[model samples]
Target chain A: MKRLNKTLYSVSLLAMALALSACSHDDDDNEISEVAPPQPVTYTYQIKVTNLTSGQPASPIAVALHNADMPLWTIGESASDGLALLAESGDNSEFLANTALLATASAEQPTLPGESMEVSVSIEDNAASTLTVAAMLGNTNDAFTGFTAMDLSQLEVGETSTRVSVAYDAGTEENTESAMSVPGPAGGGEGPSEGREAHDFVSMHPGIVSAEGGLSSSVLTSDHRFDNPVLRISVMRME
Target chain B: MLRFNSKGFRKTVLATALFASAGLAHSADLEVTVQNLTQGIYFTPILISAHSNDASLFELGETASVELQAMAEGGDISGLATATEALSANNIANPAEGLLGPAMSTTASVTTDEGNDVLSIVAMMLPTNDGFIGLDNWAIPEAPGTYTIYLNAYDAGTEANDEIRGSGAPGEAGLPVPPPLEDVVGNNGVGVTATVANDSVHIHPGNIGDDDATGGVSDVDNTVQRWLNPVAKVTVVVSE
Candidate 1:
């Protein structure tokens, strides 16, 4: 009876090996028949921005994903023409078309003070490892805020990074604080003009010295004054 | 009771050196850069120093030292330089040579000696009574990388911020009118105040001036000279 049991077990093992070979043969046949390209992997990011200022309304927020070779704007350097247009006029059309961008998204309307906006951008089969966000302070001459060239590669799926940004003077336009040159609701004047300030390098903004603060020619009031950390931004990897 | 003496300090330093030579110390060569971020404010001759952990240039909520008072009031860094030298600090005085104008920058190189692991920077802001930019005792990182720091404006609290034109001497009561600022600053002004409310080092209240450049409550220009916090940016690059 024991000899019979051992023979039966050997037969069952041989049968299992034969069945595995048959399954492998079927998989090879299927691979040969199906010749379509592999599906592309999609990477999606969700960006939420909040205006922290008491009075300064932010322009349409511009978000872009790009490689680390370039930055939207640099400190102690001249502002690009695209950056100058957005900072002075609150327009993002030109900035969105930056040559280095792999994917871009922007808010359609102004982000009022104490308001938050979320934008999502997606790209397929490309490694855009850096993120940049920017918006103009509508009441000032050319003051803007947001971070640039933030590394997004380390963030895994469903992870988020939060950062607070300080105001920057674009230096493309002087801080005259006059209604004729400011294009915001407080000013209701013309957009960016033809000339740049003598000190035409990006730097930290000196803040608005409104008419109530002793700039008699300024159209802005004391309510429009703002300080550092005007914007809070968070970036999350959705997929 | 705890007693302190120079001999005891020297012995402690010698022991630290012996232990550091056994492979625990991190000495570095550093490149320091300071930039005036204000649109219209000028920085007086700056004093940059790297000293031991116990040494400091100034502390907030404390009375200003006489040497610090001279530098904050008159941009005279000689006294502070001498004081830090006694502490065996690596000092760089006035890398800009003269006043560092708005939107300008200067650089200095310092190779720190053993155990000098902290940095401090100080400079007077022109066209104000005793306003200064200060970086108080920041630790030098052990890693080899670049670091950035933002500095705020502080009032030395040794003199009143009388916005009118006056002497730059310690205990005086007016803003210094340098040759470059002579044309821009207004004259024949009454004065902002003759007294200081806070006698300790504190954040400076921004300047206030009227539209009347020829005659106003203050001599400084409100629109041009006013600045927010973080009036200066410092960049430090450390390498072995």
Candidate 2:
């Protein structure tokens, strides 16, 4: 049998005993009378994201709070049209507006190379237990970075959750670094097109193979390249 | 203990029981999730382990053990797993089911037994011959909280990091490109190097790739395949 060690068993048993004792003490207080609910408290969440990529300046971040049942994207699944649009074009307006959110906000501006930006969102009554922040790396074809569905339940009032997130390919387009496809200043504002020919299933980004790197046909140079965890995010809950 | 009278003996036993209960509170039930923090590399299946205070997966500046070499070069956890099992260690092998790619994450739940209180994780980073992401033995906290750790890349001392495509078998040179990585990685490129500079496990120097896909200083794409340290993230939630 797969069993816990004796010490763990004893420890778990003691914890369970204590919890049971607490529940027993509360059994008598199960009153049927209902009272008026208190006014909802608005909790402000401040988000600060730093662009960790050497060259890529991240797009303005799209921040959202949703219930546990919601996830921005999942591996092996096709990205939502909104996600595809954001990943491909570096415009997060659609993605932000599309999320059925408990709360939502966006960074005021893009985070430049080695620069940081801040954004804030507020929820009524601490209703959201999960938060997700996403932004595109403007230099890539369809690469985006952020955390999806991170649980914020344990963050006490004024407490912060800090994390570094890796980049992801939306799989909505082939990583063709042509001037007509990339939307950054290096590529001159080329936005999303009707051509969506990539794998179409979200996966770990297989980074940009630049012209100075190893891809023979790529138009991007080493200055347009980047590495992992392109963004650092810190979220503080202020009630 | 027997010198006490009946009443005193009963009191002594009760005191022992209370002491035992206090010891139990020190152990934690932890659920661990490891996320690959790279944008271009892949991690060979991981070996998550929990051992005593004295044990480690691989230490910096130390020569790589045969077990460590096997794990870092070929993504084979069996040798390391065997070594850990002999020490009565807690282990979770191949938690990602297969290669965990760049910017990908996998979760493994492990309830560390009381004696095996420190956690470690190791796996080879693909597209490189012997680079690996390693978590040196970290002590699990006694308090119930969620702790997150970011891991750095390491070079296994066993093989020359000739960033070319070849075999997944142990004792062989070059990297093993899985089916998923075939399209992303280049082919017909010259090898990176033929010699091992450092024979001890050390910090991995990031890759330097050239522009030519067919004949270059490295087969890896510099923009696509290079990475900085802290290439993996581990989150542990200790349930009270």
Off by over 4 Å in 2: A1-40, A46-54, A74-77, A107-109, A114-120, A126-130, A149-166, A201-209, A227-239, B1-45, B93-114, B143-150, B167-172, B176-187, B206-240
lDDT of 2 by residue, B84-170 (tens): 989888899999999997667888777665557788899988888888999898877655678999898899877877778887677
DockQ of 2: 0.17
Clashing pairs in 2: none
lDDT of 2 by residue, A38-70 (tens): 878787789999998888878889999888887
lDDT score at residue B162, model 1, on the 0-100 scale: 79
Task: For model 2, state the Cα shift of residue B190 in Å.
Answer: 1.7
DockQ per model, Cα: 0.28, 0.17
Residues B18-95 of candidate 1: C-alpha lDDT, one tens digit per residue: 534322233569999999988778999999999887888999999999999998888899999999999999899999
Give the per-residue lDDT digits (tens) of candidate 1, residues A1-239.
Answer: 34456877787688789989997998887867656698897889899989999899999999988888888887778988888988888888898897778889999988899999998988887655688899999998898999888998666678899989999888888788899878899999886878786467887887888887778779999889998889999999998
Q: Give fnat for candidates 1, 2 and onward, in order.
A: 0.60, 0.27
CAPRI tier of model 2: incorrect
lDDT of 1: 0.86
